[model samples]
Target: MTNTPTHNRERSCIACGAKASKADLLRIVRTAEGISFDASGKLAGRGAYVCSPECFDKARTGRLSHALKTKVSNEEAQVVAQALQAHIQRA
Candidate 1:
């Protein structure tokens, strides 16, 4: 007997390797310059998904700076955060 919802299926966090769900995580895209939030989830670029705001913060905290190949400025981080928050809210 199974009761778990399909929306809660597991997904990996690209930064910390955490398993979460499509509804519980946010996706970031690797642009030509760096990684940025892919709000549409259809952006044309490499992507890394994360489970929550904290992981996003950790990624912004130098761990993913090199992979992103660019600095994650506080202002830009705020943008990603805002977009993620909005997405979560709408869902």
Candidate 2:
């Protein structure tokens, strides 16, 4: 038998509050430049996760800004939304 890790890092969706594995969710990172989607999940900054586009929409209203502890303007939110949409399409 081969040894393997059983526990996976779990994260909660900022908008829906649903718990899911890190790999199953999309990560959004907040950096000095601005907040954006982290496709690689390795960005060096504060991160938030969302499980679906619906959750993302909810987050766009307010949860995301609160979770990131930063003010996300309309333009920034739009850009993030588009990026996430594209990422989802690719997947």
Candidate 3:
């Protein structure tokens, strides 16, 4: 995967419906395998981008599933939510 620069990558915010460069957002991808962060930003799979950890809750609620065209269970969403929460707390 390519850790491509976020420049020029127009990613829409899942919560607010705002558009911005991918560099300004975090991406979560739902591939054939499972769910994971698109850290490299060049993974080949279905993707949904959010503005930040704050938006994670909303994304996991239904926005993410809607965007990815899949089901995101509450438990699965909580995992990501807590993980992100911890990361944000660390920051």
Report the C-alpha lDDT of model 2 over 1-91, residue by residue, as the tens digit.
9453677687899988898889999999999999899999999998999998778988886888888999888898888899999999999
State the lDDT of candidate 1 residue by residue for 1-91, as single tens digits.
9687876667688568887666566877778865678777678876667877777877776755655666777877788878777777787
Cα lDDT for residue 5, candidate 1? 80
Model 3, range 1-91, lDDT digits (tens) per residue?
9576666668788988778887667777887876766666678889888877778776787789998888988877777677666655665
Pairs with steric clashes in candidate 2: none
Residue pairs in clash, model 3: none
What are the per-model C-alpha RMSD values against the true structure? 4.1, 3.2, 5.8
* Stretches of model 1 off by over 4 angstroms after superposition: 1-11, 20-24, 32-35
Best by lDDT: 2
When 2 and 3 are scored with TM-score, the better candidate is 2
Best candidate (score: TM-score): 2
Q: lDDT of candidate 1? A: 0.73
